[model samples]
Target: MTDTVLVTYGTTNGSTAEIAESVAEVLRKAGLTVESLPARSAPGAARYDAVVVGGGLYAGRWHKDARRFVRRNRVLLADRPVWFFSSGPLDASAAERDIPPVRGVQRAMKRLGVRDHVTFGGCLVDGAKGWVAGMILRSGKGGDFRDFDAIEAWAQGVADALTPAREKRH
Candidate 1:
């Protein structure tokens, strides 16, 4: 049987959602059945064979929706293969090197036995919501920092890891 994968994320300004979509696209190309949804609306993880959860970072914390989703589905997630991602550094540091998850995310990953996690550069463009975003933009520090190449490479790694298990199941 083919494995069904869920790529779900939480985003305040939509950048993280795009990153999740890229992940889903790569998984689909790798021949897995995949679904991408915002964490606020995604269904429980029980139906998926594996999962990729992502959230935009804010004030050194994972988005509330993403945190809640994991909390709500802890049992199911702990039993399955799971990966995580964070997008929220408006700089090239994420593409340049490994960025560890924040304290809350690190604790959650340990609790869930998550397989892996990656931090991708974030995007903050004109018209992003929030006063902080506005301030950053006004300070000339806002722009699209997401590296599609790096994101694709990381996603391919996830696909490579899952494909073997999927083939074994066949």
Candidate 2:
């Protein structure tokens, strides 16, 4: 049986959701069955062979929805291959260097034994919700900073890591 993977994310302005979709696409191309969903609405991790969870960073914390999802599914996730990602650097810093997970994400990864974690550039275009987002836009700091090429490369790595296990299961 093909490995089924869940690619889920929590986003404040939809950039993280786009990143999650890119991940799901790469997994599908790698011959895995993939489901992409918002963390708030996603089903439990027990239903999938693997899971990829991502969230937008806010004030150095992962989005609340993503945090809750992990907290709710920690037990099930511990048994599966799981990856975590964070997107929310408004600059090129994430693309230029390794941006470590925030403290909370780090703790969660340790508890869940997550296979890998990555931090991607975030996007904050106009029309984003919240006064801060508006202020950032007005201040000219808002832009689409996501690096799709890097995101896809990371997803490919996740696929590579899971492929051996998938073959063994068959």
Q: Write the per-residue lDDT of candidate 2 for residues 58-167, one digit (tens) a residue.
A: 88999999999999999999999999999999999998999999999999999999989999999999789998899989999989889999999999999999888888
TM-score quality measure for candidate 2: 0.98
lDDT minimum window of 10 residues, candidate 2: 1-10
TM-score of each: 0.97, 0.98
Once superposed on the true structure, which residue ranges of model 2 sit more than 4 Å away at CA? none
The digit string of per-residue lDDT tens for model 1 on 1-170 reads: 35999999999999999999999999999999999999999999989999999999998999999999999999999999999999999988998899999999999999999999999999999999999999999999989999988889999999999999898878
Q: Estimate every model's Cα lDDT from 0 to 1.
A: 0.94, 0.94
- Report the number of clashing residue pairs per model: 0, 0
In candidate 2, residue 96 scores what lDDT? 94
Report per-prediction Cα RMSD to one decimal. 0.9, 0.9
